[model samples]
Target chain A: MLSKNTVKFIKTLHQKKYRNLEQKFFVEGEKSVLELLNSDFEVELLLVTERFFEQHQKQLNHLRAELLIVTQKQLESVGQFQSNDSALAVAKMKSNQYFENTQEDLVIALDDVRDPGNLGTIIRIADWYGIKHLLFSSQTAEFYNPKVIQASMGSFTRVKFYYGDLKEIFKKWDCPIYGAYLGGSNIHQLNKPKPGILLMGNESNGISEELAGFVTNKITIPGFGSAESLNVAIATAILCDNFKRLAGE
Target chain B: MLSKNTVKFIKTLHQKKYRNLEQKFFVEGEKSVLELLNSDFEVELLLVTERFFEQHQKQLNHLRAELLIVTQKQLESVGQFQSNDSALAVAKMKSNQYFENTQEDLVIALDDVRDPGNLGTIIRIADWYGIKHLLFSSQTAEFYNPKVIQASMGSFTRVKFYYGDLKEIFKKWDCPIYGAYLGGSNIHQLNKPKPGILLMGNESNGISEELAGFVTNKITIPGFGSAESLNVAIATAILCDNFKRLAGE
Candidate 1:
């Protein structure tokens, strides 16, 4: 059974303001909750269906957080998904951290990436390609947005996301700044990609003109057919894959 | 003004059954509407805001379909999006066509890709990579789904999607079958990706065991970070990019 305050807190996590104020975010579904528990992220609370508690008794014993086992009906009231999963967790949001040296081999910077799903997918892609640090413009979707967290599928635990002014950050670095553009040089023809910041822009718009002017290299995924533009997330994956391939060779 | 029957008819398009029964789908937003007018797709009706008609009178002259200019309020009554765009188009669904001989150097076969957005993104990715044929299992999202169509961003106009049993189709193919899996050979290590079908599977459960047994080669995108899995759409793009890279090289 959920206390009135607990229910209120869980519901409040749906909004960015409340999530930030509390410095916590919710992870739903069995896989995400279990993964979060095993991660370095601090779990504030764990809510589980009574059936789940019975089924995963051994795993639950390892958790250090406060646990509450409730009926399915109780779980459904606080669940975001249509079908309530067995477990839900509220974890403390990690502070934004940047590496000491700043200049690294392949960091990704997102400029005004508005879609939470896109942001999450990009983070997952970044993890796949081994790109460690992800820098985001202040206007990008919050890292704790429920949709972003859900789309990440636990990648958030591995990838570091820092939100700040991209222009200010890029100015501090003396490395190559690659920006993905529509009519730019074909990405395949580019030489080896070194340690630098690979910048991706918003969904509807490519890199902003101000940022585009500062970019050291403008690359594009050459299109053979007509698509208004690739989805920002898809574009990021392709670009990251290309960067990895070039670096490997 | 939208008639009672017209409003009812437009609303029905939201459902797959009604869409199939009518053999039509809706495309909203200015970009999609303009693309439909330019494509070979038959536009059954064009609902335009009076402001849009006045703004683009020159371009409207070339349209062969019946154009009904309505007030913004009337457009909202029949529009699917949150805020109604200037124009909405009702396009006759293209018949699912299968080629006797798979002529495309590369094709994509999706096995029960449930998300409409993922399916649409895959179609757009296929289009971008110049893969003309996209074969879908019977369980895959319908290509004519409005969300899929909208997400494709006009790429659906060029990519031919066939809905059928993938197992039957693979048995007939003379080319290599590349199935994306987790522990398979690293995709980057493959020297050549021959003209073949790249099979992507369900979001949660990967390629069904039945399909996995039939694959000639299993490939995995090597991951270095803690992400459990890549989004289906992102995975497809990475695979397609790699395929293009190897084939073109």
Candidate 2:
């Protein structure tokens, strides 16, 4: 059974202000809940339907957090999704960590990536390409946004994200900065990729002029058809894949 | 002003059944509206705010449809998005037409891609890559789905799609069929990409075994990081980019 206060708290997580104020976010659905349980993230509470508790008794006992068994109707009341999952969890937000000045790895930087779904997809793409450090402009969507968390699937557990001023960070960096644009040099024709920062910009707007001026290499995916522009997330995946392929070769 | 019947009609278009019954779908936002107006698509009706009509009188006159100027509140009530656009249009759904049997060119076949957003992104990617034909399993999200239309951002105008049984289609096709899978041969290692169909499968469950058996070439996007899987749309973009790059070379 869920207390009235607990229900309010779970509901509060839907808003960015409340999520930040409480320093907690909710993970709904069985797949995300299971991933959270196995991740380094600290789980504050695990709420499950009575049937789920009975079915997964062995797994439930292994958890270090407080477990509460509630009726299906009760779970539905606190759940954000229309189809209530067997389990949901409240995870404490991890503090942002900056990496040491390293010169041997690729990193991704986003400039005002406003869409939560696009941001999440980009994180998942970064994870796929083995890019560990993701730096977002202060204007990027929050990492804990529920839509982002859901769109990322479970990649959030593996990818580290930091929200800060990208311009200041790039000014201090010695490695090359690659920015994707429409008429830039063809990505396929570029030399092998090295450890650098790959910058992606907003949905409607490409990289800001201020940041574009700082970029060492401007590249494009080379479109053949009449699309106005590729979706930012799709473009990110293509860029990351090309970078990895060239680096590996 | 929008009549009560007109409002009800637009609202009903949100559902697949009503859309199919009426043989029309809605496209909102200024860019998408303009794209449809310029395309070969038959525009049934155009709804615009008086401000938009006054602002773009020249362009509005080019549209060969009944244009109705409504108030902002009326547009908002009938609009799909919270932040409403200046114009919206109801486009007549055209029947899928297949060209005469000819040597296969590069095409894409989606197998039960349930997510409308993914389907839309894939269509946009197809348009960007200049792949003219996209085939979808009947189980795949409909091309006219509002979410799909929104994500495609009007690429639906350029890309032609056919809905049918993929298994039967694969059996009849004599050209190479590339199936994207986890442990398949690294796509970068494949020397040549013939004019063939690139099959992208469901999000959770990849290509069904029936379709998998018919795949002549199995390829993967070669992940280096800890992500369990790439989002279907991201994977499609990467695959399409690589395929076009190699084909062009």
Candidate 3:
């Protein structure tokens, strides 16, 4: 059972303004909730249906948060999901920003990736390629958005994302910045390009002119067919695949 | 100005049942409408705002459809778009299915890819890779769904899709069949693997068990990071990239 205020608060978290104010975001579905619990991120409150609670009895035993076993009907009222039969977790946002000196050799820099689904898929791609750090331009979609989190599956727990000014950040970067473009060096011809910052730009617009100056090498995934361009996330994965293939990371 | 009957008929096109019955579908946005007009697809009607009419007067001059210069407000009500400024096209569906012998070297076969967006992106991917034929399991989402068509971004005109039983289809396949899975040959290691059918399965449940026996080679994208699996469209793009790279077509 949930109080009126509790349900309202959960609903408000769906909006960026409220999420920023509370410094929290909601994670839904069985896999996402389980991942949130297992991750280092702090879980404030967890609402689950009996089915979910029963299935995860062993894991639920040691949870530190307030676990309210709610009816499926009650869970749906507060969740973005139309029919949630599993769980929804309200988790604290970790503020481990400014990781300028991270261990990961390759970093993906996104500039104005506005689509939530695209951003989420990119996160999943980053996780698959073992690229841990994601630097997003301020214009990019919010990483905490439910659609982005859902699209990322459980990979959101593994990928680290930071929203900041790419122009200033790239100006001081010490590594080679590879920018994806239309008429650049063919990705296949590269002699195993070095590990560096891979900059991806907007969906319709490629890298903005402001950050274009910082790109040391312009690379492109050669297209063999008639489609104008690849989706941002799809392009990102292909670039990551090529980069990882070369880096042998 | 749209008549009440025109508005009601356009509204019906939004539903798959009515779309199937009418044998017509909607194409929105400037690019998609322009593509539909240029393609061999028959245009039943074209609705455009004053701005679009003036801008594309040359193309509009040759169109055989019932062209209605609609107000932006009127266009919004008749189409799926909230505030479309350019154009919306009601295009006649082409029923050219029996292409068991297309000229395109590679074919994409989807098995129960239920998401409209995934199917649309796959169609776009197929177009990008120069793969013209898309074979779908009967359980796959309808290719003509507005979301799928919108997401495809006019690639639906170029790529050919067919829905049929895979088990019977694979029984008579005369080419190599590559199925994507968790454990399979590293995509990079394949020394220019032969092209046949690239079989992708459902979003959650991968290639069906029935079709697994027919797979000549199981292939996988090497993952350096921790993502459990790639999105169907993203995976399809990477695989197509590798296949085209090897086929050198």
Greater DockQ among 1 and 2 belongs to: 2
Model 3 lDDT tens row, A107-139: 999999999999999999999888899899999
Chain B TM-score in each of the candidates:
0.95, 0.95, 0.96
| TM-scores for every predicted model | 0.95, 0.96, 0.98
Candidate 1 local lDDT, A94-134, one digit each (tens): 98776543565688999999999889888888877777788
DockQ of candidate model 3: 0.86
lDDT of 3 by residue, B1-249 (tens): 678998899899999999999999999999889888889999988899999999999998899999999988888888888869999888888783746744348889999999999999988888887788889899999988999998898899898777888888888778888999989999977887766899998999999889999999999999987788999999999998888777765
Docking class of 3: high
**How much lDDT does candidate 1 score?**
0.84
Clashes of each: 0, 0, 0
Name the better of 2 and 3 by TM-score: 3
- The candidate with the higher TM-score, 1 or 3, is 3
Tell me the TM-score of model 2: 0.96
Judged by lDDT, which candidate is best? 3
**Ranking of all predicted structures according to DockQ, beginning with the best and ending with the worst:** 2, 3, 1
